[model samples]
Target: MKAPRVAVIGGGLGGLSAAALLARGGCAVTLFERSKHLGGRGQTSDVEGFRFNLGAHALYQGGAGMRVLGELGVKPAGGMPGAGSYLLSGGRLHTMPRGLVSLLTTDALGLPGKLELAKLLAGLGRVDLAPLANITTRDWVEQHLSNADARAFILALVRVMTYCADVDAMSAQSAVAQLQAKPAVLYVDGGWSTLVSELETRARDAGTRLELSARVSAVLLADTGARVRGVRLADGTEHAADAVVVAGGPGDIAALLPADALLAHDAARAVPVMAATLELGLSRLPRPDALFALGTDGPWYASVHSAVAKLAPEGGAMVHVMQYLGGRGPEASEARLEEVMDALQPGWRTSVVARRYRPSLLVSHWLPTAETGGLRGRPSVEVPHVPGLYRVGDWVGPEGLLAEASFASAESVARALVPGQQVASRRAVGR
Candidate 1:
């Protein structure tokens, strides 16, 4: 019998990981990317000694992305500064309370509020989130806490963790799970594109054929729609395969299929929570010692990326500021982010060397809605009622969020394609 031939659409992380694993398992894999380059939203651009990524991308120390990279023997380099993060509160920057000492000493919260917060954090790990799965984070906080300061503080933490500003729509269960996990984030020495580059190399090394600038017009299906035969290119070329995998969001996948294609409704209706990001490469450090910080009153986060990674040139600084727009447009959200930046880094705008603004990417992809079982109710990698067809992206269900969900879907697809084969050396989560 001949080895199974697979055709992967989209050259993002999920596609690359799946292609590499399948090819390594003795299958013939051909990865197609419509863009001239791979890495989708993870791509980076370099200009005049400065590097700007698609958005603010960070890898959690024990995240799915790192674990997957570790399986491939790729070690990312960087470290968080010892000063840790800070929060903007009451017209001042206060150190983020981590332990008993900081919680008691930090002026961000009142002593009573701090004590209450400590209890909440301590109980988050052991709390059964099942009962709270259907409630919003806002409701949960209001129900459990009496202090206004404590409520606002926890709301900010939830926004920062879930990347969703609408606390009323955010799932309490998801927030608790993430806060409990407490994943350590890292900035790669160069940029996230560096990791993408490594994944591309690994795929090619595993005998996966990657073709750039090849636009897939549509997935070719069998007579009964039971299996995907291959794909037809935009330029009228046809490539055959035993199976097909789409490494793109639901919206992207919908565009490639027929108007009445199966699962088109789900793809179209799957609403994604978006983010607005402002990245500045400065001539000097703005917040020189801080690694990360959050706004206590709103949905904003800032990080001195260069403090943790060598992202800036000598004597230069790299800062990434992001705003989670609950329902705001780019212009409005960008303005708000600028305000946060101005508040946090006074006189810092004068030192800017280069800046980029990205306002439209699915930060959390699907909204963590308790009403919808959070991510647990998301669509599966396999297209419903279709065989030999799979979808791999953040939108795919695998009990995770963001990049972690992407990695999980990729691994799941690879395992389904190559039964009994160990595609990953160890399991890891992505951010």
Candidate 2:
């Protein structure tokens, strides 16, 4: 039989990952991206001599995505994890817990909060691995710490990082993994976009075909239920393929799916209101050393600047600040930063040589089932009775995250296709 032709829609990490893996598997893969470039919300912008990561306030090497990168031969960009954060309270900036010493005396949390957090973290770190698909981040955090302060700290951070406006909507299982994490958030020396750019290069070198500005409108299957016939593009062109993976957002998959198979899709709406407001300029220059400060402390504002020296002839350091505001309504979000900008630094607002903002998927419904959150009417693992189509998302991972969840979900789909030895030899692939 001829090798399958796989068409991956959406240029996000999940889609790119699927395409890369399928290509490595010897399948003829065609990746379609609607944007001019890959990397979904992962895009970074350079304005007036400044570079800014629009999403992901902070990321480190120890996350699921980092693990996947290691397997793919990518290394962390820079040195030790960037400086940590603190909560603002009573006009004084109070350091939040970053390690054993800080945890014992951090002012933002009480003794009870710290002890409970320690218990949860230690317990989760010790517990046997379980499938993460069935748990929500909220449940996990509550289970471990149960302290209002700790929960707020963790959930608010997740809200900003994951674009989750509805903090309570995340998975307990996913939450458990995050809170237990080691503090080694990593970024490429240049920026996170460079990582995606690297993946694209490596993938193409490995024989993957990338088609940007192209959107896959539909994943069509023949009546035989044995093979995926092809994908229908937005332009109405049909490209034939033997297999198809919906690595785009699960919602995108549910939309293209056939009516008969629609029931097979989960109706969980992830309510993550995400926003990234980046301001770039040579407004603040500091010594080429660790300079950490709270926007005022408290969970409300936190920031870090990776100084760029000799970056320009004048030698002014670049500043890229990331701000996340909960779903306070669009009008409110529009004014949040402006109102706070002057309060933080009086003259920097004018120094903002360039500013760009794009916020989407602000909210996504978590899975709607006891297995996921607490909702009903969820999709089955293999798409009900359908044969050629499969879904991958945070909800599908053995556990989910940028790297682990996406990788697990994609591998699960790949294995279900390759068949046999799934249990004896799980077809796990590092995302």
Candidate 3:
């Protein structure tokens, strides 16, 4: 008996993970990617001697992505910066409040503001975030703490964690859940593209055929719309498969299917957030004391990748400054990010060896919220309306952000494909 043939669309982490797992489980897998390279937005570009990623990517310790990597025996070599992160306020950089002592000692807030913040942090564990789902982060902050200082600090934290501002648009429940989860942050040693390469290798070693620059134009569905036969390529060629998994962005994937196709409605409704990233490769390091920093008053974040990862040439430094913007054009966002980077690393302009600016990158497919409404926003992996078809992506039904969410969807679909063999457990990886 021949093994079941599976077709995976998109070469991003979710698709790669599913392909690797299915292949490992004795399935004949073929993964199709439209781009010349794999990894989607998680890719790293080489300009001159500098290694710069599409954006700042930090794997949450013990999150779903790490678990998948662990299963493949791919250990990402690098740890968090020892000094952690700082917050910019009042024209000064202050130690971010990590604990009661830091909260009390930090000059970022006044005595009254500190007490209010402490109370809020203490009560965070007790709050039923589900109820706060409909509430915005701004609304939640206003209700909990009236002090402007406290509000600015908390809002900045939310932006840093979620990479989405407009607290009025952010789900309070989602914000609280993220804060409560508190996953460990880690920078991969050789950049995320290296991780993508490793995953590709694992899939190939397991006998999964990866086809790049193969644009899938459509998913072939049976007349009853109850089953997927395979996919049609842009070149008008059809490849048959027993099962099909789509890992593209929700909108892009939905466009491949007919209006009546399963999960199409949900996919169309997904709200994606845009990320603006400014990557600067310096001839020398700056702010070597800490690994991360956030602008409390401004919508910006900066991290020194070289301090934690081998993403730059020897003696050179790689820094990523990001701003999650709403409605702002890429050019405008880039200009704002440049200013933020300049502030974080004074005289960095003179030290610049190479630089790249990404005005717009879809960071999240479905905006996560604390409310029940946001829960059903993401479509599940299994397509009940269409058998032999599944979806896996950051926007798919999973309770995590970015890589974690992508892995969660991939793991769910893989487990469903091969339940008895015991695929990688969905455990968070941490130091």
Query: Could you tell me how far off, in angstroms, the CA of residue 389 lies in candidate 2 after the best superposition?
Result: 1.8
How does candidate 1 fare on TM-score?
0.93
Residue-wise lDDT of candidate 3 within 68-135, one digit each (tens)? 78887788887686465788754457888888999999988999999888888888877775566577
Taking the tens digit of each residue's C-alpha lDDT, what string does model 1 give over 1-431? Answer: 79999999999888898888788888999999999999987887875466787667777666667767776667878775446578876546787877788888888888889878888887877777666667887888998788887887888787766677776776777777678777777778788788789999999999999999999988888887667788999999999989899998777777766654667777665768777888888898665565567888667788777776878888888888887777332333777777777767767889989998877656755776767665555778888666788989877863556777788788888778888777554332212
**What overall lDDT goes with each candidate model?**
0.77, 0.54, 0.79
Candidate 3 Cα errors over 4 Å, as ranges? 82-84, 261-264, 327-331, 369-372, 424-431
- Which prediction has the highest TM-score against the true structure? 1
Error of 2 at 139 (Å): 6.8
| Candidate with maximal lDDT | 3
Find the 10 residues in a row with the least total lDDT in model 3.
Answer: 422-431
C-alpha positional error of residue 32 in candidate 2 after TM-score superposition, expressed in Å: 2.0
Backbone collision tally, model 2: 32
How large is the C-alpha RMSD of every model relative to the true structure? 2.6, 5.0, 3.0
TM-score of every prediction relative to native: 0.93, 0.77, 0.93
Give me the overall lDDT of model 3.
0.79
Estimate the overall C-alpha local distance difference test score of candidate 2. 0.54
Name the weakest run of 10 consecutive residues (lDDT summed) in model 1. Answer: 422-431
